[model samples]
Target: MSDPRVAEHMPLLSKKWDTDVAKKFIASKEQRWARDGLGHWAFLVDGRYVGWGGFQKEGDEWDFGLVLRPDAFGLGLRITREAIEFAIADDRIPFVTFLLPPSRKNLSALQRLGARHFGEVNYDGARFLRYRLETR
Candidate 1:
């Protein structure tokens, strides 16, 4: 999350990485898993951690998020397809919503995955383009 290229599309990342912050972030994701029965997962390549993201409950909707290291950006679509396939088989998720920063210019991958841009939204003081994909 400290990569400028990555942060460019993340509006809410306001702090630098630190041991405490890492612990807190991991704790939060674990808490979400315990509370929601599912949460983000770490992705690895060649036995090395590359990124982390998954479904997060926002109100009554399940929002999907996928963040990868700059070097691992090319794996996004493959990871997304796998994640969506999981969503399709899971009854809890009927649809998935994506909130992407307006700075993101290439969203064709999402469109290719059957996600459609329906509108925009203001989330935690950041404006984002909203996309929806039916998981059913």
Candidate 2:
């Protein structure tokens, strides 16, 4: 996204948001779907694009992530719950990992959802706090 606020805590996002970057991002998500049978999703509310996020297989674990617009921030927990429910139904996803930026202070919602802090991880040179939630 071009919005700096959206990228503030996102580490893998190295490039500035532009037409080329947006296209590549979409293409990459599509590639994931083709190869892994699952990938990111575009989330909408009231017929409007709110944000996009979903599952991506990493190594032997399935990671879950969500990035919502600033205006839709309040809906994060609800959206995440719905996504996790989807994971629960899918036999392939035994667990879901969440990598949150350390800058995020209010993580009570994730804990309320039964997610436990796994540890810290360095992803593409970016440090993040990892959390795991078992779907089974």
lDDT of 2 by residue, 19-132 (tens): 999999999999999989999998999999989999999898999989988888898999999999999999999999999999888999999999999999999888999999
Residue 31 of model 2, lDDT score? 96
Residue 73 CA displacement from its true place in model 1, Å: 0.5
lDDT of 1 by residue, 35-125 (tens): 9998999998889888999999988888999999999999999989999999999999999999999999999999999999979999988
**C-alpha lDDT score of every prediction, in listed order:** 0.92, 0.92
lDDT of 1 at 80: 91
Question: Which pairs, if any, clash in model 2?
Answer: none
Regions more than 4 Å wrong, model 1: none
TM-score of each: 0.96, 0.97
lDDT of 1 at 31: 95
Instruction: Identify the runs in model 2 with alpha carbons over 4 angstroms from their true place.
Output: none
